[model samples]
Target: MDMKQAATFIIALLCAMCASAQTETPDTISSRQLDEVVVNVEKPQVRAEDGVMIVDLPGIVKDKPVDNILEALGYLPGVMNNNGMIWLTGASNVTIILNGELANMPLQNLYQLLYTTPVDRLKNVEVMYSAPAKYHVNGAVINVVLKTPTPLDGLQGQVRAGYNQAHYGSYGGVLAATYAIKDWSFDLNYGLTSNKSWSREETWSNHLYDGKRTIIEDDMRRIGHNWSNTIFASASWKTLKLTYNGQIVSDSKSWNLSSGTLGNYTNAYNMLSPVGYHNIALRYAAPFGMTVGGDYTCYSENRSQSLFKDTDYLLGSENRQDINRWHVYVDQEHQFGKWQLNYGAEYQHSKDHSSQHYGIVGMADNPDFDDILNEDVASFYVGTQRSFDWGLTFNASAKGEYYHNKYQHNWNFIPQLGATYYKTPKSIFQLNFDAQRIYPSYWELHGGTSHINDYSTIIGNPKLQPYIQYDAQFNYILRQKYVATLYFQYGDKAMVQLPYQSPDALNLIYQTINMNYERVAGLNLNAPFGVGYIWNATATANIMNRRAKANHFHDISFDNSKWIFYGSLTNSFKFSQNCPVSVSIDFSYISPSLQGIADLSAIWKIDAGVKWLFGKKRCCELDLKEDDIFNKWSPTMTISHAGQDYRMKVHDMTRNFKLTFIWRFNGFKPKESNSIDTSRFGTGK
Candidate 1:
């Protein structure tokens, strides 16, 4: 019992089974209607104008409450969350949503359950940085909205506990419940996490005849247990309204790794990844504001690794791997009053099964590996949107897919267009264009033989081909809170990986091939001081060139050229009337490239945070955050083949602190200062 004493005895036995299974509240009560229905806080969405683009999480955590999940996407606007590690622009294929349901989990367990739920148990978190044919057309889309209780409730509850420490240490506890009677709504969430990690790896290799340097040390210990139970059973009498959103998640991760190595490198590398997910969602609504939605998800992962080598290691291996994914999706939308009618259809079947069980740990020769990969995909999508009368707006979308496995099975289509106009109203103007189709995931198709990365020898590519991107975004919304966006992207046949020097393998190897073209263009700037000071700035300069047709793929290279800057500043205050004070500052820069025979480098990072909101009895506010503030440690050297070279100066992951505490306990009824929605009587604009 030492995983923080079994995670504090399973969080004091789940808060004593939610305080003796509740069942006692209503002796003439309702917590005053939970403070008068939380005052709506503006977050009920429906702007069909053109499918995809939602920013609502209880209207951005009005008075705070949406623990983790990156604090409801760190309160929108170009979104970026570290620690909870949720990146959009830094792009790593985003996707996470709740309510409209979606969770492909695993960015290392959603960065430990987004710091274990906060922000008042959320009720919104939707972001689609492009890529929307109603959800799954892949690449860049995030949604995590959880909160639904009240619509005439029937037992609702929320509880949370947290603790964080930089280098290594974290504690948590959370319990969310809602059981809406009539229209159905049953959600139960329970979680527990304990973590510790310290990493350090430095390796330098320049060979022609053995010249090596290695330093590796990773002490990690983690214990995570999470569970989500959702059952949003819905229904409506006459004009239809059928809903059923089921949920199932049992996440478990138990890891322990301790290592140290050097020179002829006597080595060490250990890994453990155990994951799970199963979700289902279905929706159908009508009453003039037609709507239809469908969702089906299944994700599974199991990874195990144990490697120890020395004696100038030749080829020693011990591994176990398994990765699975299954998805089925459908969508449709309709609205009257602005003209909009969108459509959708999705079908996915994936089975990327890999099994590697080998033994021969001392001199080299290790065999006994099995690989199985069977993936099938079928998809469809359509869209339309219009609004004319000066402030003109028009949009269109399309997506089609079909693949049987082994090397694609035909069928593919992706397209999109956008337009917006406003002669006045903060001087508005916008236009976007898209035509994308990138498919090559499943760890790029079979990922194994990864000597804890660095021994390199990573493999994937069941033929690899399906890359075609053309993106464009232009914006200008000054005055009413400044904003400027300009971007352009182009890609063709791009999906490359080549780091060669394998005279029959033995270190000095890197594989993944397919390349024909590459292109990118960027610019962005946004500003706002309205809601108590807000600001964002970005400048990305890009130009990449790649070619292949003559000998060894006609060489062409460009490594992220110049300009990549970001700045964020937020301020809020209201000391009295129930406390409030928030301060934040973040910045990053990396503009100095040219490596691999063309030396030259540059990097920068910063972070700061402060919060104090303790008022209204069942109190709150207790936060302190410090991230890489001028503690930038750097070391990176690169070279693609040509005598092979590698050196990574590892350090940084220092200067870290997060001590947070927030408490709330109140049951319903306690807000009302002009509420509207008597089921909306006579409508007809």
Candidate 2:
């Protein structure tokens, strides 16, 4: 039988089993209330389930002056924030999701969302070392689950304001409200922010040819002004849900090359981008723990940039891009005695259009490039979970996808397997194996070029190929307080971006290309501890080795390898048992690391904060934070490849102080609400 026919047959058989396994209702039932009891104990911050690690953000960040989710992530285990980017402890490829579904936005937009959303709206964050087939993702995954509004009738809302001072002043405001009655509910969240910042960068390059060397230096200053707005709304009735999310951003920048001898290269530009997504989902539960659901999602993005240099007629450029995507999916699950089954299918289609215009003084007319791309993807998978009598649980699955582009087509299959053994109530062991494929983004495949200055430029490659990898991990947990993990991965025909210099002149070019192979192996450790009733702390460390081979640059081909280390510690203190104030400090360090041909130097940082709660009901909060208090957060880069020596340093607004105030009001007690997971749609860069 064909795959589709087989899937249909299995689903029908499972439905029959679910019907037959249902038990008859009892004729008589009685209920009684027992005496109330309360237990007081410290709640754990980290938990392990099957093969995934769950971090309770509310329990960990309660005493910290964390306004947003990004600030709270610094205290989580195995997570680091380098500038505005997130880097996992031992993984090269990682994806972030919202409430178990794909975020469907760019990196900058994701950062903005994290900064604007308050931490009180978050419940838990799940970290998966290897993604399952049901998720439709390639590598490691981080899922952020938000707190659903209480289902009780009445109204609740919060108002917040904050300000920060660095190179300049920045301010923001947020408002959120929720209302529920009977079986219907509604929620709204809106935020606005504005900022002004100054930054500086220094670069030095040495070119070698004909047994001689020439040096060049470029130092630049940038001044920027930006404003952004975000809005989200949701409505639910019984088993049906609908959500809408949108963002609008505007940015303007002015820059000058102050110490370069390249004839006063100066530029200014303005950009505007808007993004939106709409999702609808339905879920139903039947007899014998059988559940079914489906989701339809729509996403779109529009961006425009205008550029000018020296004079409007000397050098100018304009670019615009528009994207639209639609996704549909259906899933089913059934639970019987010691066995569970899950299956799903999904389809996605996307259309992207981009255009650019370039103008120079000597050109007769402006040069322009325009292109359109279409892509369609279909996927299906079946997974099963079972618990054996010998204190062992296992899960296994197989999946495949048919991918088609305007000019090419392919089919691929992957397998996933995991097993766990419960040695005792306090100790456990787990092993996991996964395989997946990674594809490049739309702009990367369009072969677009954008100029940086007179002698430097960046370009994309249209001939890039997709790559696949196989990963394996082993983990051990003790008393739910300590953890150790070991992992390894190997990839063939991988890809990486590198900087290249022209052999005859002092020109620099950045481009991406496919490599022969790459391998990574790593280990991670974590522990949480407490001293008496006033002190608590958590520590994490990671060590890894990486190697890349068969990389080519001009006439030279070489291999690169390195060892990297990372560590972090977070401490919290309470002055007394009756006080409503607390203090927290966080410290972290990263040793030298290698990214392809470039070598990065070590970096360290320290942050401290204090929080105070007031009012009869503790409805008001005041937070004071000092970021990079020691002023030791600078990162440096060095490269020595293809007879070129280069180094670059950036000093931006990495240090700052901020104060915030929040007032909350509620007319009814909050109750937990139930929401369906729609995380498999709107996947993007």
Candidate 1 lDDT, tens digit per residue, 1-685? 6789997985565444345434234334455467466342422322212324444444433433334556557545555555455655423245565444343443443444444445555654544445456655444456665555655656655555666665666565665555565555555555655555554544445444334433233322222333343333344433233433333333433222223343233234333333344434445555555445444444444444434333333343444434444554556678668877777665656565555554444424333446666777677878778878877777677878777777567777777766667756556666666666666655545444444333444554456666776666665555434445566665676555644445443454554555555555555564534332232222222222222221233243333333334445433323222234444555555444442232334656676665554445334555566666665534344544444454545454555666665554454212321000011000000
Question: Where's the lowest-lDDT run of ten residues in candidate 1?
Answer: 674-683
Against the correct fold, how does model 2 do in TM-score?
A: 0.85
Off by over 4 Å in 1: 1-17, 20-49, 53-123, 129-163, 168-199, 207-384, 387-394, 397-415, 418-468, 471-642, 645-659, 663-685
Superposing all C-alpha atoms, what RMSD in Å does each candidate have to the true structure? 24.7, 13.3
Clashing residue pairs, backbone N/CA/C < 3 A, model 2: 101-679
Instruction: Supply candidate 2's per-residue lDDT for 525.
Output: 90
Candidate 1 CA-lDDT value? 0.48
Q: Rate the local accuracy (lDDT) of all candidates.
A: 0.48, 0.68
The candidate maximizing TM-score is: 2
Kindly list the per-residue Cα lDDT of model 2 for residues 431-542, writing each as its tens digit.
8778776677676667666656766666666787777877887877777667787888887767777667777666777777777778889998988787754777888888
